[model samples]
Target: MLYIFDLGNVIVDIDFNRVLGAWSDLSRVPLASLKQSFTMGEAFCQHERGELTDEAFAEALCQQMALPLSYEQFSHGWQAIFVGLRPEVIAIMHRLREQGHRVVVLSNTNRLHTTFWPEEYPEIRGAADKIYLSQDLGMRKPEARIYQHVLQAEGFSPDETRFFDDNADNIAGAERLGIPGILVKDKTTVPDYFAKRLC
Candidate 1:
């Protein structure tokens, strides 16, 4: 069996509020205002799809959000979104691999976000046999083609593959391809959930 995991929230604990908090301190924008105004628009999607460079995305974000900060400040606040790594999930994945299952990552993320996780959670990135990044893949999740690309490229059987993600839409997308998806509903319980079954 193959276990495909998502990077954010699933493997690495993340919260956009963390980013907003850091940005609010730097920009003097209230957290509520920042949260309300910040949008994951085309610029963000384009960044994840590797069309927009990090500098371009940051500039676009600052302009759209009316954030009063320099590029350095914006980059610093952006990195704050990552909270920590899921050690339990990583361990379970390793154990599953030891038990003969293939483990891989399929993440919808950008280059700016990439710089942080690897430094913070080296083990999480190394745990996977293959790490598929949206920026590198030129596509993002909930898109049928990305899922199709990974499955076909790996020659994985949909019946034997399980995708773990935190988003409902991503799960639906995988299901459309006949790939079973497990939603990481409660991050705390994810370790136990995998430990019991796959390993």
Candidate 2:
């Protein structure tokens, strides 16, 4: 069976609050205001969809949030959102591979994250048979087309494939394609969940 996993939260620990706090400190923007203004706005969405260049996205974010930080500083804070890799999840992936299950990653992430995560978490580097990113595909999760795109491109049958993601909407999207999905809540519980099912 083809087992698809989401990157953030599912396999890697990410906290938007960490980025918000860092950016707030750097930009001198109040945390609440920063959180409110620097949302998944149009520019952010465009960046995730690979429509905006990295420089343009960074500049747009600075302008919108009235951030005084240079592009490099902003990028640094942006990439700091990821805390660490979930080792248990990596172990689960390894076991799944041993069982001859095809594994891959599907994430709604942008260039900044894509650039930093692999280097920061080498444990998952080359772990997946394929990695699908929203920036590269011009599509994001919770959208039916993205799931359909992966299913078609990888020649995975919907009924035979299983998807794991932290977002309910993304899970729903996979279900819409007739793919069974597991909504991952806590990273610590993932290994046990998969063990019971896949063992």
| 8 Cα displacement, candidate 1 (Å) | 1.0
lDDT of 1 by residue, 113-144 (tens): 88888888889767888899999999999999
Cα-based TM-score, every candidate:
0.96, 0.94
Q: For residues 97-165, what per-residue lDDT tens digits would candidate 2 score against the true structure?
A: 888888889999898887888888887865788899999999888888899998888888999798999
Give candidate 2's error at residue 53 in angstroms: 1.0
Runs with alpha carbons beyond 4 Å of true place in candidate 1: none
- Measured by lDDT, the strongest candidate is 1
Worst lDDT 10-window in candidate 1: 190-199
Global lDDT scores for all candidate models = 0.88, 0.87
- How does candidate 1 fare on TM-score? 0.96
The global Cα lDDT (0 to 1) of model 2 is 0.87
